[model samples]
Structures are given as structure tokens and as C-alpha cells.
Target chain A: MNKELVEKIKNDPNYQELVSKRSSFSIKLTIAMLAVYFAFILTIAFKPALLGTPLSADSVTTVGIPVGIAVIIFAFILTGIYTKRANTEFDDLTNKIKNAIKEH
Target chain B: MNRTFLFLVLGSIAVFASGAIEGEVQKQALNMSAIVMFLIFVSATLGITYWAAKRTKSAKDFYTAGGGITGFQNGMAIAGDYMSAASFLGISGLVYMKGYDGLIYSIGFLVGWPIILFMIAEPLRNLGKYTFADVASYRLRQTPIRTLAASGSIATVVLYLIAQMVGAGKLIELLFGLNYEVAVILVGVLMILYVTFGGMLATTWVQIIKAFLLLSGASFMAIAVMAHYDFSFGALFTHATELKGIAIMSPGGLVSDPISAISLAIALMFGTAGLPHILMRFFTVSDAKEARKSVFYATGFIGYFYILTFIIGFGAIVMVFKNPAYLDVVKNAVDGTSPILGGSNMAAIHLSHAVGGDFFLGFISAVAFATILAVVSGLTLAGASAISHDLYASVIKRGNVDSMKEMRVSKIATVILGIVAIIMGIMFEKQNIAFVVGLAFAIAASANFPILVLSMYWRKLTTRGAVVGGSLGLATAILLVILSPTVWVKILGYKTAIFPYEHPALFSVAVAFIAIWFFSITDKSENAKEEQEAFEAQYIRSQTGIGAEGASH
Candidate 1:
């Protein structure tokens, strides 16, 4: 580990500017939270209850298949978004920090 | 689309897929060969436990798997351990019941990873060792700080373990047709063996194995589900909407409201980094780098797993609504108000039957049972570690420690906790234990997270601050949970209850943060340097045990 590398990251203006960008996450988190909370409320307000039955027992089976397909499609989108960001943003910063620290 | 056609599809598939020619699950599930194979799996788990107990050699191995697991293995284990009965059955179960409400928890849980990746993982890997308490107590002394963090960690693990155990018992009875008490005892004994014998090593292996199996099982279901839509993304969304209404395909309802959604996400996102057991996995790895890599792997694995759960939940509703037989009973049970389903855990099982038949259902059930075993084993190891390592060696023996004696204490603690879990699981067999498990996360996020975060960043923190913050956080969370209305009626499902706080995580986490700041300011006399040095040593020990695979080794 290089001691001077630690000094550079601690003092470097460029690195400090990058560090300053972290506050954006806190803001993004707020947005994500709002999306979840408001969505939950709106769904209940509009639908109130499932348009179907509660106890689908005894009956052979008619429920899950199509519903699952829907969820799978939605999940693919969600995961695609997560994978994209994790690589582009998270991986980039984490690697930079490691590089700076390792040199130290 | 008619009743006759739906029944014909389901009934014919159910009969043809059984493979036994008998076409019955209840009958073939109890066969002699299957029983023997089940016993073999149980025995293999016990053998590892036996190995753990014999090779105990030192206190370090008992607590942290000698701190030698590679990042990849540790990552798998972390995902494995953290996934639990809740992640496996609970999330999918939620999706099964609530259409989109299930999506709320999935989004809440998976979205949390970005926070850790951006903020906490590396710092936590670099901070104090062993327990989250080690981080908190870095600035504070042992008496109050360590005790509070330990208490919080222990209480959370114990309650969560009870949920896992009781859930296993009931689930096994339903899936395997075994006696309820017998199933609980079976899992209890296997977990005790896993922890008491192989200690952390056995527990880690079991968790890793469980993670792989769970992932594979979920992937299989996801594939079958995608197949139903002919690999067309557009088709899936449209079909799902057709089955459960367009609302089910979308992500909103109660959570669309910002204030409540943000508050809930706060608990979840921060909660992941804060969780003791999850963070503890970082310590199990040999170095800080390994910890980082593990998180990356865990992020990918867990991300995919959550998506699979969402699909499984939707699948249950679609298969039933289309076939009619599945929805008929569920609709009647919940009075046409609930989804065409009765329980969330059933989502995966029902999906298997819909796609493959009773045989597939039985096999999926077996995997689920194995999942409970893997999770419970990890939880027990965690509990035993807190007791034998933190309390026994650190507190009871203080500076002068006997390695062999500490190992023995861990084994005994393992047995004791296992028994206690069995008793509690049975007591709460009928109650919805998921809420109780959530409380564990609440306390962990509050008491454990702050101490860990502060210790890593604030170089000037004093011992008193750690002590006050941890104690205040732990006490606030537990007290609120005990008094909360949900715990009053839902946990034990008791009829008489008062108090209305459905979420103690929201309040307890707040109090903990305030206490940390207040106490740190008040206690200005403690030596900050000494605390930092001591905390680092503990962290090193946690990541690399004293005699095992740590740097010293």
C-alpha cells in the first residue's frame, strides 16, 4: 500500500468534487420512497379489493399462471434498471475509492 | 376459459405428472425411499455440525468460521443467511396474497442494496469486528455499549430464529404431511448439530448450498413462467394484466404516497447495511476486498431472486384464475376479497403444481424444507456466536481468555438456544410470525446500524457515546415492539391487546440516532485513540480470527 496515494485522495480537489456528488443518492432515495408510498396508496384507493375470490381452494386451479407472467415482465424491467445503475454509477465510484485507498 | 376446460387441464396434468402412476402426493410423499433420502440430507447436515463441534479448537472458529471464507463464498452465504424463511416464503407469499402489495416489499428489499453499495459495505468491512456491537462500543466502554448491542443482536437473532423455526414446523406439516412438533424438533436438532459441530463452517456451507438450491428452484419457475408467454415480454405484461387486472401488473397502491413510502424504504435500505447478521458476513471473509466482492455477488444474486419471487406470486394468481380450481377454494376461504389465494408461501408450491403436477409440487416442497434448514442453521450459529464470543469470552473472561473453554461455552449455548427456539415456535405456531421477524430487522437497523456507521466515520467518538446510543436504541426498539398493537394481537395472536404502533423500526431507529449524538457530546473524557485502536483489533479478529486464518495466523 502506498502512503502517498492516501494523501492524494484526501487532498485532491477532483476526488473531493466526486465525493460531493454523493448527496444525490439521498435525494434519489427520497424519490424512490415516494414512488413506493404513493403507489401503495393509489392502488388501494382505486381498487380497494381484488376483483376476484379470496379462498380459491377446493377448486383445481385457475389463478397463478398469467399473474406470474405479469410479475416476471415487471421484474425483468426492475432488475434491468438496477443492473444498469449498479455498473455505471456504483461500480465506478467504489472502484475509484478502492484505487485511491489501495495506493495508500 | 370455462370451468370444465380449466378443471380438465389441471386434473389431467396433476394425474400425469405424479410419476408414481398413483398420481397422489399425500401417499407417495410418505414412501420409505423418500424418507430415507430425507434422513440422509438431515444426517449430512448433522455430520457437518459434528465436525464443527469437534474442530472447534478456539473461540474464533465458533463465531466467525475462522474468518477465512473467500468473498464469493461469503457473498453467497450472506445472501443465503439473509434470505431466510422470510425472503424465500414470505415475500413470495406477500405477492401471492396482495397482487401488487407484494411488489412493495420486493422493491423495498432489493432497492436497499444500492444504498449499501454506494455507502456502507466497505466502511463496515473496515470497521470494528465480530458483532455490530464491536463497532458501537469502539467509542464507548464494555458495560453498557457492548451489552446493548449484544442484547439487540441476540434478541433480534433469537426472535428471527423463532419465526424461522415455527415457520418450518408448520410448513413441513403442510408440505411433508409430518407431525408439526416432529418437524420443529427435526429442524431444531439438525440446526443445533450444524452449529454445535461444524460451528460457523458447517453453517456457512449449509447457507451457501441453500442459496444455490433456492436460486435454481426460483430460476426454474421463472423459466416455466416465461415459457407460458412464448418468450415475449409484451405478451407477459398483457397476460398478467388480463388475469389479475392491469393494476396487478403495475407497481402502486398504498406505497404511491411519498411520506409513508419513503419512511418504509428508509427502514429497508438502511436496514440492510445495519443488519448484524448480514454485516457479520463481511467479517467472516479474510480481507476487506473479499467483503466488497461478496456484496457485488450478493447484489446480483439477491436482485435476481427478488424478481423471481415477484413472478412466482403473479404466476399463482394467473394459473388459478385461468384454471378456476385453484381460485375456487382460495376465493371462498378469504370471501372473494383476497387474491385467488390463501397464503403467500403457497405461491411457489402452487406454481409448481400448475406447471409440473403433484410430483413437482412435492419436490419444490422438499427444497423449501431444506431452505428452512439452511437458514435456521445460520441463524443459530449467529446466536451462539453472540453468546459464546461477545458475552462469554469478551465480557465474562475479559482480558484473560481460555480458547478451549470458550468453544465449549458456544456449544452449550447452541443447544440452549435451539431448545428455546423450539419452545417459542410451538407457542406461536398459529400466529403470523412475519411481523415478529420484521421487528428483528427494525431493532437491528436502529441499534446496530448507527453504532457501526458512527464508529467507522467519527474518529472522535467516545466510549460513553457508544454505550448510551446502543442502550437507548436497543431499549427503544424493543419496548416499542412489545407495546405495538401488531405484536399484541398478531404475534401470539392473543385476543386482548392495546397500543397501536404497527412499526417500531420507524421510531426506534430515530431514538438511537439522537442518543448516539447526545451521548457522544456528553462523554468528552474517554480516550478516542485508545478506543479506535481497540476497535480495529476487534474488527481484525472478527474478519480474521486470532488463531485461525486472520493475518496473525
Candidate 2:
């Protein structure tokens, strides 16, 4: 890209907003994922029995099964949430930044 | 096209001749249905390759399928690449043996997708052209950065290829009653043809088809198992617990300590992001939006596939365990405990026959072999790209090479990689290759991921810092794995390992980041300053997709 166009986009508020909003959003989502995963990993590491406990007194199903499946589902859901926001909100700001540079 | 057909015929004939010679010694009945299904899959993929070869006219098409794949198709392809035979048979086999412990791997592998989607996918699509080295070397010195990235990529690819090839040989031997050497040669030749002739387009389609078949077959197995239990997991678990005790419902011996667990978790998560084949899929899509959508779909398919594998594992425990028909009676008599035919890794395969009968078993076997072929093809293509694109065209020719020559170089690299994979697969046939995959994940997490992420986000990442830090991470990962228990004690017959843990990502990744930070900040060179100044433009393009490759199209 040309230096002038890059400078214009860099100084544009839309670009700034897009960058900040998207980065923070991604960082937040990433932390959420890491927190969830690490929590499970720590549980597997430290207290295996906690996840080993059955769902009910008479149940053969353990707590870990649901928790593990939930983690997998949680990952998919987070990706969905991010894709939705990125394709709509983030793309809008990007297009606005592009338009501003073109107008200049 | 005629040469391609001739090559395929010769390869199949060689495989059959070897299989026949080995069959006499083994005295194993050939699985005709499995052989037929495998032949069908091979012919179909070869057909796709012929079509793809006609369309693969440029270096662009050779690498990223001319950036024409849709989000959903790319998503399936990514899932195909991720859900290899290792994950399918390996993870399910773990579950069948250890129960809940297998889910740990499934979860570790699945969790990487969200992080990739949030952090790497869009920037990778915007900044890269063919390989991830494109993105990593965006503002850094091309030669050093490309060399480092390509080394890491090739290392990761070859290690992963060896594991997949070994697993394929073993699985095919048990599933199709084929000879191990024949299976390896078949995989090697087919993979070389797909990649050299068809390139990314053929490889992607093969993965998509294999992913579909694998998902459908596993889904059928899981559903059949559930149906036997009235669609209640509680019933399946109840029966499994009754047969194998309640320990099957809980964690066994997969992860014994905290450090190992965390280290392994780190490797599995970040390793997915650093994988050249998986990362290369981002460029297969048209734009950032498609990239984002692809990850969404990929995560869903992969996550769901893991769930199915988990179910299949539990189902095997319920249905295949202690079943006299599936058990090797002579081995069980000697061992005093019933062992399933072909080891625990064949748990899901045996479960297919138990639940869905011989025809389904044949289908699953074909799908399993197809999965191996697709994964190895992708790995060879990625390795070839690392050699041809990063090392040859960029580093050697200094970006002056023509596209046609680059394509030829890649095809040559593909054939060499295929041969190496076959040789290594045969050599490691009797060795414990489970750690090889773990080592691949560690190298990727520690080496490729840190440099790629730092180059994009860290403003001070110079060529010196990247090369030094990346090479250190790569070396550390390899060295530590050698010293770790899996290699040192298990493979090398050492008394005790110097390193207590089996995984080195937690330490090696930290070392890489710290070294990169230290070296980058300490370097006050004019080149370093220029790189830092150039980051703004790179970041702008990364975020906004301005001047991104294939963006105009």
C-alpha cells in the first residue's frame, strides 16, 4: 500500500475504532476460551476425581463427559459469535475506512 | 492424463503383488469388500486429480486452489485436514481403552479452533498469499524469515507425515488384511500423484470427501451404538461400566501430573494454529469474511466429529469388549484376558463390525485409509510449498523465479517427500510413533506459532530476532523431546529420562517468546528500525485487507 493511503487509514477514526474494537473483542474471546480450556486441563491435572464423580448417585455417567462435551460445544459457539461480529460489525468499519481513503 | 493412469495402474499392481507375497506368509484372509471400497475411493480421488491438474495452470492454483473454494467447502477441507486417522482411530481407541481420558485429547484439539478463529485466521488470510511464510515474512527479511518458517513447516510436516504413514500402514494391515509395506507404498504413491499432479485443489477435495465419509461412518457407528441402548448414553455407559467397571467412566492414566497436562494442552491448542496445512486453508477462501466463516464451520464439524468419536469409543466398550467373535481367542487364552483383534486402536473399527456388520466395517476401513491418504497428501503439499515457495523461489532465487519453474520445483519436492515418508513409515513400523505426533505438535507450538504471532503483533520483530528465536524454539522442542521420557526411556532404552515430562511446549514456547522479546528489543540496528516502521503498513493491510493477495479478484 502507498504511504499516504496507509497514513490516511491510520489516522481515520473508523480504522482506529475497528482496530481497537476488534482486537479487544478477539482478546476477550480468546481469554474466555483459554480460561475454559485451562480450567478443564487443571481439573484433569489436579483433581481427576472431581470430574470422575458420577452425575447422580445411581448414574453411571460421570461429570467429565458432560463437561468435556460442553467445552467442545463452547468452542464452536465462541467461533460462531466471533464470526457473526467480525463479518458484520468489523466489516462495516473496514468498509467505512476504505471509503474514507477513497474519498480523500 | 495417460501417464497418470499408467502410474496408478503400476502402483496398484505393485501393491497387489507385494500383498500376495505377504499374504502367503501371514495366512490371513483378504477382506475383499474393504479392498473394493478402497479401490473405489482411490479411483474417485484420482479422477478428481485429473480434473484438478487441468485447472492447476499456475503457482496460485497449485497452492491455494486459485482462491476459489467457498467458506463451507474450505471449512470441510480444514476439518478433513484436522480429523486425520490419528485423531479418529487414535483418540477413539484411547477412549475405548481408557474411557474418559480420550476426551481430554478431543477437547484439547477442538479448543484450538476458537483461538485460531479469533486471532489468526483473518490476519493470516489478509496477509498471506500461498504459505504461512508469506505472512510471517511480510516485513521481516525474506531470506532468514522464509528459511526459519520453512524449516519449521517442513519439520512439522515431515514429523506429522511419519506418524500418519505408520498409523496408516498398521491400520490398513489389520483392516484390509494387506501387507504393511504394500500399504505404505500405496499411500505414498497415491499421495504423490494427488499433490504433484493435482496440487491444492485435488488435495482439498480429497480431504472434503474423506472428512465426509469419516464423519458419516463414525456417525453411523455412534448412532448404531446408541440405538442398541435406546438412544440413551446413560444406558451405554451403564453397560460399559458393568463390563469394564466404573473406572472406564472416569479418567485413567493419560495425564498423571499437572505440568504434563498443561504442557500437552498448550501443544495441542497452539499446534493447530501453527500447522502449515491447516493454516494454508485460510488462503483457500476468498476474503477475511470467508476465512472467518470457514473456521466457524470447521470448528463445528471438528467438534461434532470429536463427540462422535467419543461416542464410538464408549460404544466399543459396550459392544465390542469381551465379545467372543471380535476377540482373538488364542491371544485371549494366553493372556487370560480377552483382547480385541488388532489392538485397541482398532476399537472403533471393530465396533463397526459389531454394530453395523461386515459391510459397514468395510466402509469404515475404506474411509480410514482415505483419511490417511488425504492427510498425508496435505502434509506433502505443505512440505513441498515450504521447499519450493519459501526456500527455492524466495530464498534461493530471491523472488526472481518464474511461476512455472516454482511449480516444477514443488512437484519434484512432493515426490521426494512422498518417498521419504514411505521410507520412514517402513522404518518406524515397529517403533512407537505415538510420540512423533506429540513432538510435531510441540515443534509447531513452540517454533512456528510464536514467530508467526510475534511477527504480526509484535512491532519490534526483526529478521534476526525471528530467525534466532524460531530456530531456538525448534531446536529446544526437538532436544527436549529427545530427552523426554517417551524418547529417552521408551525409544532409546535409557534408564531414566533427563526430562520428566513427555511434552516440551510449555517450556520451549516460553523460551521462544522470551528470546524473541529480548533479542528484538536489544537489537538497535537500522534494519530493526525499518522493520518496526514497516509494521504499521503491514498491520493496516492485515486488518483492512488493503493490498492483500487475491483481494482484488
Candidate 3:
């Protein structure tokens, strides 16, 4: 509720670091996931045959199966990447900022 | 291992709810095993309700389970809240009928989890209380914003609830041989009982149980399908293609259009984040970290479940499609193909029979039925909370009411909602309500998602901007859907649709974002300036969880 505290936290080094680091990290991961998903969608629309074709001549499996699985796997991996960083790096910075505000 | 075993038990209860063992098809005499299975589910959940009633002593417990839920529990509860009968029966039915196109729904639904994890969950957990409108109204005019948000929540919940209820009625008619009215009333009574007495604690446990049942049952079906193919994806595809042709493995006709596909993709992705019921789950956890972790576990569970559905579809393709035992003996004269035992929606049910026989068939059917019950309860709770908490307490009383009185109002609202769901379910029994869910999503994405995102990140957002822009988004989404092919041509029997596309999110969502941005920047009201100034305090609390509401425990 304090105007001075608001100004102080906004200018605090720890707060700025947390915001910048977390926002950029989240934004990059979100864009990556969106690209992969949209690429899959667009390919279905424009280049249908590419996903329809079999992976190899002998196998009955199409290229789309692995790609679909890959998308699911990719989601988990991205989530892991974010969670790992958030739990370790981001939480540490957030705690430091909280403590500093409390002391002040 | 313990968790997996728990899911198996939970999943088996769902099958019991479906009532499949006795009569998947043929109006044969009722089966006792299925009845017993359903009774077990009934008794167990009723016991949970009784236990939850003992602890639900205040408004907080009624709405958020006192924020005492753990990350894993909340994750499974979310899955239960989300994975409706539509996901289990509808996607499998789509896969059974259309093949590879079914996975599009799978992927579209799964992608929203990560977005929520990154942006909405933490800030929402910190800034809001009980409902999403709490956060959206943080620095704005509380009355108008809360009113608009409550309206949006009710619209989405009611439409979605009707779809589920109607689907339940039809499914029960087939699986249990019950009259349509009776089935709808049963669902209504049970949902009211869960929310009115047990509240969020009961609702959370019910969802957790339902999610487990769904995951384990789907897993069992998928495993059985794989075992038949010697655990080889290639073998399953080979067998499936033999029945449906090579297109079964391709994107096929369901998504050939670029515009429609992208529109659908936008609706599913953004809509999940904006859903009132889904957003409400964030408040059940103790902190932002648990909220984040809940999404992580949800994504993992939901992703794994979808992969199983792919197999289940292919399994049905090989086992149930064109198979004499699971089909009508009389063939269609022109098509020369036998109708499936109960219809395409029962494809997963028949596949259970093919692999696990009578008992498993009954089990899967009950799980599908239980899926509907759990989903309906969640939607009811959300709608009730919107009415009592946002509308009555914040707007009418201006936050001056007692907690006990508010809780009483919420229970009354739940009863009203349950009756409304039943009535709407019966009325829309013959209507094509499948597209209604899509319209709900479009409204949520267009109206709620844009306003929510802007309110959090954009410091310049004004009360006028959020209300007007959100109302426009809401209105446009509804209007466009009415003019679109699904409603205009198909439902109204028009020769041609004014709006060519089936989805409205692609256009409406953009309109909302633009409107909110343009209006906020142009506004010169003194209150607007004050609202903008207050954003700094909100931003600090949202980011750092400082001075945010704490868990009572």
C-alpha cells in the first residue's frame, strides 16, 4: 500500500532481474511451442501429403505418427525446462527480493 | 506404482457408472455385474460427500477447499474437471469414424496447459480469491467488471453444462436403458448434492477419483490394444489402415482448410486458459509454486491420456469396425456396412469387449458415465460461485455480507443451476448441441482471455476499455456463431450460411485485443488514471505473492 515501497521494489535490482529473466524465458518457450503446433496445423492444411506419406517404403507407419508423438513429447520437455529453471533460479531471486522488501 | 494402482481403481469406478455390461446394444435383460459396479461408485462418492461436509465450515472451504490441496492432487483434480465424456467417448468416436483427424482435438486441448502454466496460474493464484473475476477486477471498477465476468462465466458454464447433460441423457439411455428424463434428473440431483453439501472439498475429491478412473481405464484399453498388436505402433497402424485406408494415418478431410484449422486451433488453445472452471482450479492450491506444478502434472497426465486415445481409436478400427459381433446383423442397403453396436460413440466401449470381454465392457461404460457426472458437478460449482461470490457478494452487497449467508446463497444457486441443466438437457435432446461447446470456448477466448491478459500485463488498461471491449468480444462471438455454417445452415436449415467459417475465435479474439488496446489508450477519465496508477501495487503482489491471501492451514 506504500507508494515509496512500490517505487523501491520497481527499481530494486532483484525484482528487475526476476521480471526480465522470467518473462523472457516464458515468452521464448511459449513462442517455440506455438511454432511447433502451428507448423503441424499449417502442414496439414498446405502440405497434407508430406505428413501422410509413410516414413519408409516398407513400413506402413506414416510420418505423421512420429511427428504427433514428438509434439506431445516436446510439450513435456518444454514444461520440464521451465519448471527446472523456475524452481531453482527464479525462486531464489524471488526469495531474495521478498526478504529485502521485508527488511526495508 | 501406488498412483497407477489408485488410478486403476478410480478408472474402474467410471466404467461402473457407464452401465455397459448389461446392454451395449440389444435391449437384453439387465446385467447384475454392471449394477453392482455402479452401486459401488455411488456408495463411495456419497461417503466422500459426507466426509467433505464435515470440514466445509466456511466460504473459503466451500469455494476453494480452503486452499489446502497439494500440487499432485490438484493436478489430477484438474484432469477430472477437464476430461469430460467428450474427450473419452467423443474423441475415440471421431478417431473411429475419421481416423487421424481426431488427434487434432487431442493436440489442441493439450497445448493450452503450458500457456496457463507460464502466464495465468501464478499471478492468478496470488492476485485473486475464489474466482477469476477477482483478479480481472483487481484495479478496475469492481461492480461492472464483476458483473460482466459473472455473465461470461454463467454463459460459458450453462452452455457447456447443457451439452454435457444432454450427452449424459443419450449415453444413459443407451448404456442403462433408462428413460431420458430420468437420466437427466439423476445427473441433476447428484450434482446438486455434491456442491450443496460437500462443496469444493467434495467436488475436488470427486474429480480426483473420476480422473483416476478415466486415466487408468483409458490406459488399460490402450495397453490391451497394444498387446493385441504385440506392442508395436507400426502393427496397429497397419491393421487400422487395412480397415480405413491410408488416410487413417494422415490429417485427412477434417482439417484440410487452412482458415478453419487455424481458427479451431486458436479456440482450443486460448479457450482452455479462459475457461471459468479451469481457472478456478488455481485457487485450490496453497501457493503459486503449487499452481505451477499442478499444470506440469496436468499436462503430463493429459498428454499421456491423449496418446492412449490414439491407440484406442486405432484399436476400435481393427476390433469393432465391420466386426459382426459388435455390429448390427442387418447391413445398410446402400453402404453395405453394419452399424456399430450402439453407435460410433460406443466404439471405445466395444473395443473393451473385444479385448477384456463383458466385465471390462461394463467397467468402461460406467467410467464414461462417471466422467459426465464429475464434469457437470465442476461446471455447477463454477456457475454457483460466479452467482453468489461475484454477483451477490461483491456487486449487490458490495462485500458487506457475512460468510455464512454467502455460503447459503451459493447452495441455493447450485440447486437452481442443477435444475436448469436438467431442463436444458431435456430441451436440447434432439438438437445438434455438439458445436455449442465450441461457441462457449470462442466466447471465453474472445472475451475473458483478452481482458485477463491485458489487465495483468498492460498497466494502461482502463475500466471502460475492459468492459466495453470484453462485451463487444462476447457479443461478436455469439453473433458470428449464429451466422456460421454450424448454426445457420445446419441447425436453422438455411441453404447457405452468412458466415462461412465454423469457428469465430480467429477473428473475434483479435477484435477484442485491438478494442481493449485502442479504448484504454484513448480514455481520459480521472478514474481511468487512478486505475492505471493502482496497477503498480497489483503488479507487485501478483509477481511476488506479497500480502496475497494465505492458506488457512
Candidate 4:
């Protein structure tokens, strides 16, 4: 690690803002990850019997796969939402502070 | 000895010859309509490039469109970039061929948008300038931290570019019977040009334009699906069941094994969130609010796209039943190697042809071609940025720079990276193409996301902790992927799979998280108190930028 980055890290308002932006990700990350996880589980647990397979993409696998896949996908979505929000809010605040410090 | 072998040798020679040839030929597909389309595309591209070139007076504008793009536009651009040839052709084909299984990819992918909206969009937007490296290095040392982020970004971008490049080749071969190498190089050059001249502004506009077309095209087809079935989903479902002979709609159509389903889902959700090209989308927006809006719009648009994909996929099942396109690759294909691409991409193409004819086929094909080009351009640019900007400028130069000089380096980097992609594309022309994307997702989930999340949230996440943890995660994820059965055995023609775990996401994600937490805790820092105070003050300010409700700071 370079000395300058450490110095910048110490002074960076945006970095601090990003660091605090963690609370938002923490709130939604667990549930979104879990929702996808649980959805996958429930889908597998109860592969409910439907009439003739609805015109599928092609093959007739268990209902668990697509739904499970969907759920797993949800995890990333949840995480992305968290990161994007955190970065923005954090940066704006940091920028403001930096501006203030510059004024002083 | 065999006809197949004879054809393969001939095909290889033809590919080699074309790759050597610098001049253009009278490609039949490049007819009058195509000429017009290319004019429009090229004009649009060059126009954006010139504009971007002019506006790129500083490094800031060159890398991030001057951070002026609205979140909604950025979101749309993300959608444009994210909805690649894979999403357009592959998912549709998957849904067309696999039925409910295909929906897994679609829903999983689109679902991540809403997650982006609610969770990470704004914070990420407000947190960084230009690149993700800026975000990570904000709190950490530049050398190791920038190196890790740059490497991770590079890995993601290259893997992603390869995937897009592969898709371009496959689509070209399918649409035009040119050999795969020709297809790859053709698209590769087009992509290089797209990025070389235009930069971010051009790329953004291309994406915005393409996104609207893709969604509208899907929308048109979706309407056709409803009209075909009298707009009754029940009728559509019933018809689908009759065609499938199994319960396609009611849960059982998901997977053969339930656990496989669970694991697969875990891979995709985490995977989507962490993707390099996708995560980079958050950086494009000017503010958090717009980022949020972009995600919401993308989710809504994509939700419709997913639903339409289902309809279209199912339509193929019915269409193929009535008219077997190639009668299942075995009876139709010259060999067993290539997939029967007659499923989703072909279905939509076929539907367009059926409804309109040569004009329509050419239009959709043009759109598909442009779709792949636009995506490959973005992926290549991101990769080049990771290398030039993140690695060279930020890490190598320690974020110290003259504006114009750094931007020039980035341009040179872009050219170099583009050439590399072209070489790789030509070399790996015939391998299973879409799998390139799966590998990309694996890298993203395992390498980038962990460090990004932990750095922002964990106060104890010291520079050493971030550097070590980030590298470990990146190395572990990439190494696992490199050794996985897909690459080691299948692609490399190796005898056996080296690693026990096929999917890196499951293990890599956990390892990265543990490493971050462990390193952050074990080392108590002298700078910790000052860092804490600064971080708290920054947080209060950031909270102000969160929507009005969140402005309660």
C-alpha cells in the first residue's frame, strides 16, 4: 500500500460516506439473499404437480430449478441495490465534507 | 477419413484465410437495408464518439461521462449493456428449448435490478468517481487496494468480453453461414472501433438506443403471443401443457433434482449482483436518485421482457412442435457438436420472418448484430479501463496524474485490450461460447463483491485486510474457475477435473467474506480512531443524498 492512499483514506469524506453506507446493504442484503435462498428451498420442497407441463422453454424439469435459479439471482440484485445506494450516498456526503475542508 | 472431419478442416482453413484478409468482401447480408442500417449505426456511433471526444477535455469526462448522466438514463444504459446477445438470444433460446428452466436465468437476472434499486444504487453512486477502484481506495492504501480492484475488474471485464465475443461469433454463424472465426473477428473489430473513437458518451448513447429497441422488439412479440392465444394466460398455459406433456407451469418443470436447484439459485443471485460489467453500471449515473430510478425502470422493463421471454420460449415449443426447425440437431445438424440454435433466437427470427419476410429477418438480425456489438464494446471498454485507468493510472501511478496524459494512456490501453480480445476471440472461436458468461459471473461473485461490500460497511477493514482479503478472494475465485471442469477438462481437453467444487461462487464468496472479517478484526490500527471519526461525518452527509425520506440527516 502506498503512503498517499493511506493519507487520502484518512482525509477522504467520500470514503467515510461509503463506509457508513454499509447499514443499508446490511438491511436488505440478508433478506434478499434469504428470499432467493428460501424460494429455492420451498420450490424444491414442494414440486407441486401441475397438469400437462405448460409449454416450457423445452424440457420438463422439476419446478425447483427455475425458481431456485430465480431466487439465487435475487441475491445479486439485492447486493447490487445495496452497493449502488451506499456508494452514492456515501460519496455525496464525503464530497460535501471535502468541500467544507477545502473552504477552511 | 470422415465427411465431418473433412468439413472441419475446410472450415478451419477458410477461417484462417479470412482472418488474414484485411479487405472486405461482398457479404450478401450487407445488402441495401443493411447498408442503411450500418450508416445509421456508424453515424450514431461516430457522432457520439466525436461528441465524447470533444467533451473528454478532462480525465473525468472520458471515464465517466463527466458524471452527468441521470440515474434513469444510466439504468437504461445498464439494461442495454446487461441485455446482451446472451440475454436476447440465449435466454430466449433457453426458454424456448428448456421451458421453465430458462426462466431461471431471466428472472434471476432481472430480479437483481430491484435489489440494485432498494439497496446499493444510491450509496454506490454517491461513493465513487469514475471507477469502483475509487470506492475501494477511498478508505484503503492505493498500491495493494487499487491493484486488487484493478485486477478483479480486469478479470471480470476480460471474461465478460470473451463471453460477448463468443456470442458474436455464434450469432454471426447462425444468421450468416460464415465460419465462426470470421464472425468473431468481424464483431471484434467493430467493437474496437466502437470504443476507440466514441469512449463513454458514445457507448452510453448506443446502449440507450439499443435498450429501447430490444425492449420494444420483445414487447411486439409479447403482444403477438397474447393475440395468438386470445390474450388469455389460462389458454396459453393449457396450450403449453398440451404441447409439453409434463407439468410445465406448475413447479415440477423447474429441475430434476431439488438440491441442484437450490445451489444453482445461490450461484445466480449472488453472481448477478457481483458481475463487473453490471456493477460498473452503478458508476455511470450522476446521482443516487437516478441510479435508483434506473434500477426501477430496468426492473419494470425487464419484468416485461422476462414474461415475454416465457411467452416466446413457450411459443417456440409450440412452433417447433408444429414445424420442427431442424428436427432436433441430431437429424438436422451436420454434426453433434453445435447446438440446435433453432430454439429461441430462431423462433423470434422465424416469427419476424413469418410475419414480415426478408425485410423483417434482416431487421431483427441487424438489431441482434448491433446488440452483440454494443455489448462487446462496453465490456471491452470496461476491461481496458480496468487495466489502463485502474491498474496503470491509479495503482501504477498511485492516483497521481495529469488529466490529458492519463486519458491518453487509457485510450492506448483500450486499443491494446481490444486487440487482445480480438486475438483471444479468433483463437477460441469454436468453444462453447455462452459458458464464457457463466465463468464471468463466477469471478464477479467471488472476487469483486466481497471487498466492495466489506470496505464500505466494516470500519475495521484496514488496508492490509482489504488488500489481503481482496487478493485471496480474487485468486481463489479465478483459480477455481480456471481449474473447473469447464475449462480444465472440456475446453483445455484435459483428462480430469482438478477441483472438487465445480461452482466457485459457493466457496469463494464465503472465503472472501471470512478473510475480510478476519483481517479487519485481528489487526487493530493506529489510524482507526481518525478513520472512524471521518467515516461517521461522511456518512451523515451521504444520508442527505438518499431520497427525501432518507434526507433526514
Top candidate, metric lDDT: 2
Docking class of 3: medium
Q: Give me the runs in candidate 3 sitting further than 4 Å from their true place.
A: B1-29, B331-334
Which candidate ranks first by DockQ, i.e. highest? 2
Off by over 4 Å in 2: B1-27, B551-553
lDDT of 3 by residue, B250-298 (tens): 7766565677778777888888999999999999999888888888888
Could you tell me every candidate's TM-score relative to the true structure?
0.77, 0.95, 0.95, 0.79
Where model 1 places Cα greater than 4 Å from the true spot, the runs are A1-104, B1-37, B47-56, B256-259, B322-344, B431-434, B488-501, B526-553
In angstroms and one decimal each, the interface RMSD of every candidate reads 9.5, 0.8, 1.1, 8.1
lDDT of 4 by residue, B452-515 (tens): 7665556667776777777777778778766866567756778886863345666777787888
Each candidate's DockQ: 0.08, 0.89, 0.72, 0.15
For candidate 3, what is the TM-score?
A: 0.95
Residue A79 error, candidate 2, Å: 0.3
RMSD list, candidates in order: 8.8, 7.2, 5.8, 8.1
Q: Per-residue lDDT tens digits of candidate 2, residues B225-255?
A: 8889899989889888888888877766666
**Which has the better DockQ: candidate 1, or candidate 4?**
4
Cand. 4 Cα-lDDT: 0.61
| Between candidates 2 and 4, the DockQ winner | 2
